[model samples]
Target: MDKNRMELNGFKWPDGDVHCRKVVFSSVIDMEPALRLTDGRAVAVQAGGNCGVWPAWLAERFERVFTFEPDQTNFDCLVQNVPENVTAYRAALGSKRGRVGMCLDTRNIGAHFIDGKGSIPVKTIDSLKLKACDYLCLDVEGYEMPALIGSVQTINEHRPVIQIEDKGLSERYGYQRGEAIDWLKMLGYRVRHRVARDVILSCAPA
Candidate 1:
């Protein structure tokens, strides 16, 4: 049996110094994010899932975890470390369904994104069939906006708790920050918890 451990919050590899604890958010707010996974039956979508550390951990708690990463090197690492329950895909998620050129930031593996001055393949969340994700984690460099846009159907269907990395990097990737928040709000998701550069959004069951 593998030993289970919990570290404060940190990056997987290559981007080791990007500590989750050190993330700085624009606002100081505390809203309880609900992670109701007592049933042990939940789906997940980990866009830009680098090394699968967080999603792998969630797999231990949930019955099924699905992760995605476009980087080949990171995908290899994910396969080695992720548990059997966690399924990982080597592809990028976007507003459309197709392959797109990607940029590999060798220095900061976590910063990799779609290529072409800020573009990449896009896949709709509905097409991924991730309808009941209990927890959805997004760490895509600057493409978070498009990923979220493509996931509108899924968000409306599952209303899973989402943790997104929000900074000023969106503009670099041809996106706007306000658009991301507005989209989530349109889907009835509210900010549950925020820590530095990360914001967790959740929607209560109706």
Candidate 2:
């Protein structure tokens, strides 16, 4: 087996030689936020775990990690890569509870969402019955808005620091740019930083 291709097995962009790829495969997209976190549980949505790198990152720092991924193909590998402290769930998260269609991008396993191909059940974060969390990471393509809607109670109650990918709005998945920020601000969260393709929000005093 080709080692390079093996590296690309679960990667979002697996096309060219590893050295030649435009974007490098990051075990965790951003590190500063996680590095600054001192303690508490973390919740990671859109677990298209591409080697479970991000989840593993969370597990290493937080007391416990709860991650969700609806794609079976990605879930299979995700299950194998997470640490014992990380709980991996094979489900989609949205504003409401129900099943929705998932569009899978074969070229990039990490891009799967509830817009195309197959149908998957979605659950609300409020239903998780979580008592508290310190960090929240969302990368569910364009479905971040609905998922955040479902997590309103959690956000207000737990006040976890939030990070979300915001590149899919123009692609027509679900949300628009700055939409999540507006919702988060309404919940007493402020923009911590806007870097690259992610917007980091924190529940700090205004």
Candidate 3:
């Protein structure tokens, strides 16, 4: 049996960090803006859902959470850790439908990213065809631009609050550092808050 299991914030997690056996997100994605702006708390989406920690938390706030993870081992952990209200997809979120390779992080599973070269299926947030999206959080290790590009339609339609991790990792995907903020600006999302490693964007006026 796989021994990579442990408790994280009172939830089951398939521990993967060889260095610490636990990895923590900088902070939970804020849902207040989503709840305040949207008519209903119907759906939320999370990319790079390693082991399901954040998604599990989202499950309590949204009626449904659709999470995506491309790593097989991590996907298994995600499926096991997340609550029944969450739907896990074993695929990477990108700007379109396709397959790509990943640059795996053996020490920190959450750090895995696209290398543009393997068989991991890449999907777009729009592919979910959700009736409503109250919130969306993406931490794709710098491949956020493509993921955001893929989510344009959904954002245009629902204007959900979006939280993106921007630890200057976008360069790996050929995007200028901090480019996502500009992209979101064009979509009419102003930065509402800057948490530890994420920037929360919302359409709500200040």
Candidate 4:
């Protein structure tokens, strides 16, 4: 165990955020908007399942939760920790289907990002062909734009409430600041709330 990493519920967590049951961001900012909009019947797609905390949280409020984690170590933790109803994918979600590498972090497991040259597999959200997706949450470091791009079909069809982490770190993925929100706006989705680094978005009603 690293001095800065702590183990809980059989999962390795960043020491600073190892509070009771949260890996990082709480459900209030990450999962609540969707629950409120869909009345807890939202079928959710989420990414960066650091230690399964978010997915477990979603499962409690949403009808079904599908989570993606690209980090093998974190994925291992996620699988063992998430509720049985929460489907966990060990691959990262992106704009295309393929494999990429991750930029590992020593301190924060959630800080790992796709650096475009690793063995980790990448799958598009569209690839899932989900029948219903009323909510989507993405925290994939700087790759939220690509993930959103990959989810265009679902977004267009279901008009799900979306919550994405927008910490201005997209430069690592060659995107301008606020690029994801800008692109979403182009599709008529507007920001509904901004909590810490997360931005909640929903389609404007017709």
Candidate 5:
């Protein structure tokens, strides 16, 4: 593994597991907003809820949480794991609004995507018109860029701290990795740190 890349635990991401259980953005970091979730009305928007690890964790800190997942199996598991404060949606966040076919990752539930023969509905963040957001976490395989593009209005309006998995750029998942960073920089968000598979970026004031 590259020195900069994190070493995967064999138990959590055993070898030969093509899409292991290792990609969701859990709120394990020590960021102030994330850590201080109990104080404010933290609203979290999760692009890919997966098995609901992030949403379950976020529900403890934030007042309200919104999570979206395209895969039925994963969505079902997510709904079961999260609390009542967490609102789960069955859809994909993309650059546009409509249905598309998503390629399923049989091994890693978190690695599913709307790539080919997706057959899933894709919607933009702008369409939801959420009132406010304190933290935004995205992990939609390699489709983070389109999802981020569709979230321009939300990002600008809410200026919520954003965390995105730069997988597509480095791996064969979505778009080029640098695309996500460049877009964030263009939007005035700064790279706060990297945790596991995602880079934590923040533009909203701390």
Candidate 6:
């Protein structure tokens, strides 16, 4: 591993595994505001923050930011890189609020956890009562649905612009990318941007 890179338990998937070091953001994408966060007095949530790069970077531009990751090794790295404005949680965010087991891929630490398996301690976004979040980012492997389900209340209340990774990996998890998009549309979000495998959704203020 590189001296600057943090090591964590790898991620486990149904098809394979991956050992993720850290996520790097494009300078252009990182600088643009997803919604109306220009004044920087916005709340943001980053689900599945691998090494805190995105969240930490956004925290520098936003007033408040929150991130979640269940892997202990990743959490340790997150604590080191995340800014004080960003609150980092060493727990998974799921549809339900309870304890669950999170599977780790020994090879790629970033690919950890499947939707139904890897049960670990978690809190639903509804329980958080996070209102008025300007931006939301989710990259929770195949567990994106459950995490979105948990954040229904937050999404409806805050109407945050969401940036999600939606590759065709749904087949590996017995789901479809359309299904996820449909669910988001039903929740009143519109597809704002599509960058290869990534999908960004935005909704008007409620």
lDDT of each: 0.66, 0.68, 0.81, 0.80, 0.71, 0.70
Choose 1 or 6, whichever is better by TM-score: 6
Candidate 2 has its poorest 10 consecutive residues by lDDT at: 13-22
TM-score of each: 0.76, 0.81, 0.89, 0.87, 0.79, 0.79
Candidate 6 structure lDDT? 0.70
Highest TM-score model number: 3
Tens-digit per-residue lDDT, 53-128, candidate 2: 6777777777778888787666665676678988887888888887777776766666556774446778888898
Q: How far off is residue 188 in model 4, in Å? A: 1.7
By descending lDDT, how would the candidates be arranged?
A: 3, 4, 5, 6, 2, 1
Clashing pairs in 3: 101-118
Error of 2 at 129 (Å): 0.9
User: Worst 10-residue stretch by lDDT in candidate 5?
Assistant: 3-12
RMSD of each predicted structure: 6.2, 4.0, 2.4, 3.4, 7.4, 5.4
Candidate 1 or 3, higher lDDT? 3
lDDT of 3 by residue, 1-206 (tens): 35776666665555656642444543453544434555556898988888787888888878999999999888887887888999999999889899999988778777788897689999999987778988888889999999999989999998888888889899977899789999999889888777677888888877
- Residues 115-136 of candidate 5 have per-residue lDDT tens digits of 6544688888889898887788
Give the top-scoring candidate (lDDT): 3
- Which lDDT tens digits does candidate 1 get at residues 99-205? 78876666556667777633334566668776476667777877778888888778777777887878867887767865677678788877766656777777654
Give the clashing residue pairs of candidate 4, or none: 100-118, 101-118
**Model 4: per-residue lDDT, tens digit, 18-99?**
3434436445445665456553365888898888888887888777899999887677767877887899989988899888
* lDDT minimum window of 10 residues, candidate 6: 10-19
For TM-score, candidate 2 versus 5, the one ahead is 2
